[model samples]
Target: MTSLNVTTTTLYMARTISLCFLVALMEGLDLQASGIAAQGMAAAFQLDKLHMGWVFSAGIFGLLPGAFLGGLLADRIGRKRVLMASVALFGLFSLVTAMAWDFNSLMIARCLTGVGLGAALPNLIALTSEVAGLRLRGTAVSLMYCGVPLGAALAASIGIAELAGGGWQVVFYVGGVVPLLIVPLLGLYLPESAQFRNARESAPTGVVRGLFREGAALPTLMIWVSYFFTLMVVYILINWLPSLLVGQGFSGRQASWVMLALQFGAAFGTLSLGWVMDRLPAWALSALIYVGILGSLIALGLASRWESMLAAGFVAGFFATGGQCVLYVLAPHFYRPTIRATGVGSAVAIGRLGAMSGPLVAGKMLALGTGTTGVMMASAPGIVIAALAMFYLSVRRNGAQID
Candidate 1:
C-alpha cells in the first residue's frame, strides 16, 4: 500500500476502536450497575439473597437471546446498525431500572437492559477485529475491551458517592443517559465494517451448519466450554464479591473501594495480557491465566484484612476478566467473515448461561451457610476444566491454520 493509503487505514482503525471503546464503556457500567446497586436494591425491596440472585440472573437471561439475535442480525444487516440499536435499547431500559416501583418491575427493566448490553458486545468485537486485520487484532480488541473494566471502575466511584447520600438510582440514571447520548455519535461517526461489506457477496450459510461444519464442531464445542466456565467465575465475582466482603464485616465503603481496585486491575490486565497474547505462546498464556485465577480465589477466600482483601480482589479481577478477554479475542479466529458474528454471538450466548448461573449458585451456596470459602472451592473444578479446554483449542490452532 502507498503511504497515503496506509495513513488512511490507520485513521480508520483508530476511529473504529475509539467508538467501539465508548460502547464497551457503557456496557461495562450497566453490567456492574446491578452489582454495585445490589445492597441498595436489596434494602429498598426487602429482598433476600436468593431473590437478589434471581434479579442478577434475570438480566443475564436477557443477554442470552440478545447475543444470539445481535450476531445473527449483524451478519444479515450490518454491525453498525445493530450496534446502534442495541445501545438505544439498553439505555432506555436503564432509565426504567432507576424508576422501578416493585421487585417484578425491577427484574423486567434489568432484563431488558441486559438484552441491550448483550447485543452490543458481539458487534463491538466483530468491528474491532475486522478493522484491525489479523496482525493487530488482539491489541485492538483489548484496547476496546479495557474500557469495560474502566467503566466498571467508574460505576464503583458512582456507587461510593451515591452510598453516602443513599441515592442508588443515580448510577442507573448516569448509565442510561450517557449511552443515549452516544447513540447519535455512533450514527454520525462510525463506519460500517468494510470486511462485512466485502463478505456480503458470498452465499450465506446456515447458522447451525456454519458453526459446526468443516472441522468446526470440536472448536465450537471447546469454545463454548471455555466461555461458559470462564464467564461463570467472572460473573460470580462481579455480582457477589461486594456482598461477600460486607458479610465478612467490611464496611460498604471498603467493599466499594475493593471493587474499584478490582476493576483497575481488570483494565490493566486486559491491556497487558492482550499485548502478551500476540507475543507469547497460547498454551503459556492459558496456563498463566488459570493459575492466576486459582491463586487469587484462594487469597480472596482466606484474606481477612482490608488491605489483603483489596489485593486479592485486584488479582482476581486481573486474571478473571483478563482471561475472559483472551477468550473473546480467540473467538473471531474460528469462523469465516460471512458467519463470524454468528459464531461469536453463539459462543457469547453460551457463556451467558454460565454467567447467569454463577450468581444464582453462589447465592444458594451462601444461603446454605457454605460461605465464601466453599463458593471459591466449588469454582475451582470448573476453572480447571476451562483451562484444559482452552489448552486443547490453542494446540489445535497451532496445528492447523483456520481462515
Candidate 2:
C-alpha cells in the first residue's frame, strides 16, 4: 500500500473502531445494569431465585431471534443501517425497562432490550474485524470488544456508588438516554463496513447454508459449541453472581465490588490476550486461558474469605469472559464477507440458548437445594467443554496461524 493509502486506511480503521467502542460500551453497560440492580429488582417484585432467573431468561430469549434475524437482515440490507436500527431498538426498550412497574412489565421490556443488543454484537464484531484488515485484526477486534467489560465495570462502579438509594431504575434511564444521544452521531460519523459495502450480495439464505458447506462444517460446528459453552458460564456469572454472593452473607456493595473485579480482569485479559493470539499457537493460547478458568472456578468454590472469592472472580473473568471475547475475534475468519455477520450471528444465536438456560438451570439447582459451591463446581465443566471445543477448532481446523 502507498503512504497516502496507509494514512487514509489508518484514519478509517481508527474511526470505525472508535464507534464500535462506543456501541459496545453502551451494550455492556445496558446488559449488566440489570444484574447490578438485580437485588433491588428481586426485592421490588418480591421475586425469588426462580423468578429472577425467569426475568434473566426472558431478556436472553429475545436475544435469540434478534441475533439470527438481525444478521440476516444486515446481510440483506446494510451493516450501518442494521446497526443503527439495533441501537434504536434497544434504547427504546431500555427506557421501557426503566418504566416497568411489575415483574411481567420488566420482563417484557428487558426481552426487547436484549433483541437490540444481540443484533448489535455480531455486527460489531464482524464489522470491526473486517475493517481492521488482516494484520493486527485479532488484537484490534479484541480491543474494540473491550467496551463490554469496561461497560460492565462502569455498572459495578455505579453499584459501588450506592447512588439510587437501593433503587435500580436510574441505571436503565442512563443506559437508555446515552444511546438515544449517540444515534444521530452514529449516523453522522459511523461509516458502513467497507467490506460489507463492497460485497453486499443478496444471498442471505445461502449464507446460512454456507456455514454447513464442506470446508466450513467442522469449524462452524466447533465454533458454535465453543460459543455456547463459553457464553453459558459467562451469563451464569452475570445473572446470578451478585445474588449468590448476597446469599453467602456479603453485602450488596461487596458483591458489586467483586463483580467489578471480574470485569476489570476481563477487560485487561481481552486486551492482553489479543496480542498473544496474534502470535501464539491458537490452541495453546486457548488452553492456557482455560487452565486459568478451570483453576479459578475451583478456587472460587473452595475460598471461604470474601477477599479470596474476589480474587477468584477476577481470575475467572480473565479467562472465561476474555475467552469468550476471543471467540468473537476468531469468528469472522470462518466465512466469506457476505456471510460473516450471519456466521457470527448464528453462533451467538445458538449461544444465546446457553446464556438463557444458564440462570434457569442455576435457579432450578438452587431450588432443589444445591449449594453455591456445588453450583460453581458444576459450572467448571462448562469451561472444560469450551476449552475442548476451542482446542478442536484451533488445532484440527483453524490452523496454527489463524487467518
Candidate 3:
C-alpha cells in the first residue's frame, strides 16, 4: 500500500480499536463488577450464593433487550447517538446500584445496567468491523475485543483491593465512577462506524423482520444458535468458576487469583485468535476453539486435583472465550451497512438469553449437588452443537451469503 493508504489505515484502525476496547472494557466492568462485589453483597444482605448469582445474572438478563433495542435505535437514528445513550444509561444504573440497600433494589439496578451493556456491544463490534479493511477485518475486530478480558482483569484486580479495604460496596462504587469518567472521553473521541454513516439513508426501520427478508432467515437462525450456545457456556465459566474452585478446596483468595489467570488467558486467546483469523475462516477458527473447550472441560472434570484444576481453568478460558471472539468478528459481515447494527445487535440480544441461562444452569448445578467435574462438563454439549451449526452454515459448504 501507498504511504497515504498506510497512514489512513493506521489512523482508522486506531480509532476502531479504541472504540471496541472501550466497549469491551465497559462490558467487562458491567459483568465482573457484580462478581467482584458478590461476597460483600452476600454478607451485607445475609444472602446465599444462589441469590448472589441472581444479582450477577440480572445485568446479563437486561442485556438481552438492550442489545436488540440499542441496535434498532442505532439503525433508526445512528450508532454514535445509541452509543452515547447506552453509556450514559449504564453509568446511571451503576450509580444507582451502588446506592441500593437490598437484593430487590440491586436486581432492578443491575437489570437496567444490563440493558446498557446489551445495547452497546453490537454497535461497538459493528463500528470496529466497519473501519477495518476487509483483509484485516477479522484480526482488527478480534484485537478490539481484547478490551473484554483486559476490563475483566482490571475488575478482578481492583475488586480484590477494594474488597480487602472497604468491602464489596466499594467495588460497586468504583464500577459506577470509572465509567462516568470515561464518558467525557467517549464523547470526545468516539466516532460512528463509517459504514453506518454511509448506509444511513438506505437503512430499514424494522430490524428483526428486515433481517429475515432476503434469505436471511436460515443464516440468521444459525448465527443465533451458534452464538447463543457458545456464550451460554462462556458466561457460565465467568460467573461460577471462582466459587466452584472454592468448593474444590481452594481458598477464596486463591480462587480469585485463578479467576484472574482465566481472564488474562482470555486476553491472550483473543489476540492470538485475531492473528489466526487473518489466515482462516472465522467459523472454522471458532470450531477449533470449541473443540478445545470440550476437551478442556472433560479434563477438568476428570482431574480431581489442584494443579490440574488450574490448568483446566486456563484452557477453558482460552477455548470458551476465544471462540466467542470469532462471533464478534464475524458479526459485521452478516448484514449490509443499512441494517448491520440491527443484525449485530439482534444476534447479541438473542445470544444474551444464553448468557442469562449460563449462570442459571450453574446455579441449578450447584443446587443439585453436582461436583466440579459435572459443572465443567455441562458446557461441552453447547460447544459441540454450536460448532456443528456453524460448520453447516459456512460459505465453504453451501455458497452461503454473509450479507
Which window of ten consecutive residues has the lowest lDDT sum in model 2? 394-403
Error of 1 at 112 (Å): 0.7
What is the TM-score ranking, best to worst?
1, 2, 3
In candidate 3, how many Å is residue 263 off? 0.7
Better of 1 and 2 by TM-score: 1
lDDT of 1 at 8: 95
TM-score of 2: 0.96
* Alpha-carbon local distance difference test for all models: 0.92, 0.84, 0.77
Model 1 Cα RMSD, Å? 1.1
Candidate 2 C-alpha lDDT tens digits along 169-197:
77788789888888888899988888887
What tens digits encode model 1's per-residue C-alpha lDDT throughout 1-403?
Answer: 6999999999999999999999999899989999999999999999999999999999999999999899999998999999999999999999999999999999999999999988999999999999998878889999999999999999999999987895889889999999999999999999999999988878376865798888888999999999999999999999999999999999999999999999999999999888888678878989999999999999999999999999999999999999999888888888888888888999999999999999999999999999999999899999999999888877776544434
* Model 3 lDDT per residue over 1-403, tens place: 6999989868867975786687678678667777666766777888776786787789899999999999888888877778877877887898898899888998999999999888888777777777874666777777878888878877778766864676766656666777777767777877767776777887666666878887777778888998899889878877777677777777767666766777787888888876776567746675688788888778766766676767777787777787788777666666777777888899888888888988887888887899777877787777788887666555532243243
Assess every candidate by TM-score: 0.98, 0.96, 0.93
